[model samples]
Target: MARRGKKKGRPVSGWLVFDKPVGMGSTEAVSKIKWLFKADKAGHAGTLDPLASGMLPIALGEATKTVPYVMDGAKIYRFTIAWGEARSTDDLEGHVTATSDRRPSEADIRALLPDYTGLIMQVPPQFSAVKIAGERAYDIAREGEIVDIPAREVEIGRLDLLDCPDENSAVFEIECGKGTYVRSLARDMGRDLGCHGHIAVLRRVEVDPFVADDLVTLEALEAAAAEARPQGEPGEDGRIVDTRPDKERFAALDALVVDTGAALDCLPEVAVSDDAAQRIRLGNPVIIRGRDAPVEASEAYATARGRLVAIGAVEAGMFKPKRVFTGR
Candidate 1:
């Protein structure tokens, strides 16, 4: 007995807070989830290296528009640094380039925390996604070229030592602004302490509005799909079953998807009139006159009838649509 092929996915929209596991690239994760939900389009807010794991916010359908906001938000990473060896990539996956026997004392590491905090100039690793000469630095490095990535100012809101498991390794957590690399931090900290080191384990604990609380594993999602799927009619041979997303399955998947506006909830919101919402949807700027209007906010989410209409910039009491959300 043979079953029919599955139908092409429909326009599914929302955000999925996926707890990505190690050894999975962000793109691969996105592809897997997209296939599972049969979504029309998908993307991720940030890139989690194959060596690192944790919250990877996947945007489906209309939710993809808010990816930039999530990417620019602050991120929290808890990682372990293995003392004694420095790697070419500043992580476990790369080749060892140097080694040292000395390990920094807890007090010594704590004493230097203030120096790493706030804004500091940090150099990115050679094997990085950073662009140089219109090409990826990692690609150039792979070609056996000397990649010199200059130091740039990055903000580290907090860097605290969590535990000292042993003389060989220590764990720490950090909350940093965009463009900050944990691998570079591990490498530089080791150099400062006279013990060459590299990142051994790295996991992102938080990204702005997203946290561990919202994380759902891929296995769990599969289970949800199976549980939601209605029993299919058995073929004459009883060896085949139809597999297609009915309304019930779509409802089940929708339960897991966060609203498209959830990513932009951090920003102030403005409510517009029915007439104004239509004008804004047409890319026209409208004057929002009300006490609830944002006074100094350069950007905000505009809603009408309790539904997110668009993201817009406000200036002199006028709200101009920047990015509009078209589909549900």
Candidate 2:
């Protein structure tokens, strides 16, 4: 079995899509995986709240450079809302600030959800990580200061009512763009229903190319690591074993780090000859041939001196340096 943090002596590139467990922040998950792989550099594509879980793409090494490519993709979440109550933080973590005797009907919620399905304006919660005046809005709220965060336009591509377990509990799934906040959405939905509501539970179902089905649990990860350890290693008592190291020996370091290039699958591949590859590696601009005329105008194709620049792809036939890998 392979030993983690073995100092393999060279960098490799790849992407690790994590099914982030609830109650753990995205940064914490990244740090843990980084230590497990013994990776020098690693970063996550987006931040998931401790209350939310799912589809956190961890980019290792060179893959970190491609994070911006997937940052704008849509995200899907499955969340539950408790009707007739409002919270200070707009979620279960907050203190209940308001309550009502009225409970919205399932049909009413279904009808109301359609109004939020398309382009909508949502005011972010005051107790949020959004930066205002160079400080987190939540920090200001925690200080008992009343902060008025303005509403911003956000796209809710899809909002489907999945279940209504009771008169006061409703479940729904939403597909939205980068900045959509489920907690805020719940709060606004309460306002729309003429009653109070707050998010009781939230789970990210998908983010672009990743989904919940791909998630690996912490237990599974530990098992994998145990299986990967070298076999027949003597125990403290001189007996051979087929298990992993003690918890104290499990270093909080990444054992397998991947390069950044593997993270961004959007870049078009442009293979170049050995000479041109060397030039491109050295940051020299090379002219590429056989590129389509329309591709020349694409933003992905960086132009220098009226010629396409090589952002990442290589030229196949000649030592041409100017071919744009139009991830097309």
Q: So what's the TM-score on candidate 2? A: 0.77
Looking at model 2, residue 171 earns an lDDT score of 93
Q: After superposing candidate 1 on the true structure, give the runs of residues whose Cα lies further than 4 Å from its correct spot.
A: 1-8, 227-231, 234-246
Worst 10 residues of 2 by lDDT: 319-328
Clashes of each: 0, 27
lDDT of 2: 0.69
TM-score for every candidate vs. truth? 0.91, 0.77
What overall lDDT goes with each candidate model?
0.88, 0.69
- Candidate 2, after superposition: displacement of residue 67 in Å? 1.1
The best candidate by TM-score is: 1
What would you estimate as the lDDT of candidate 1?
A: 0.88
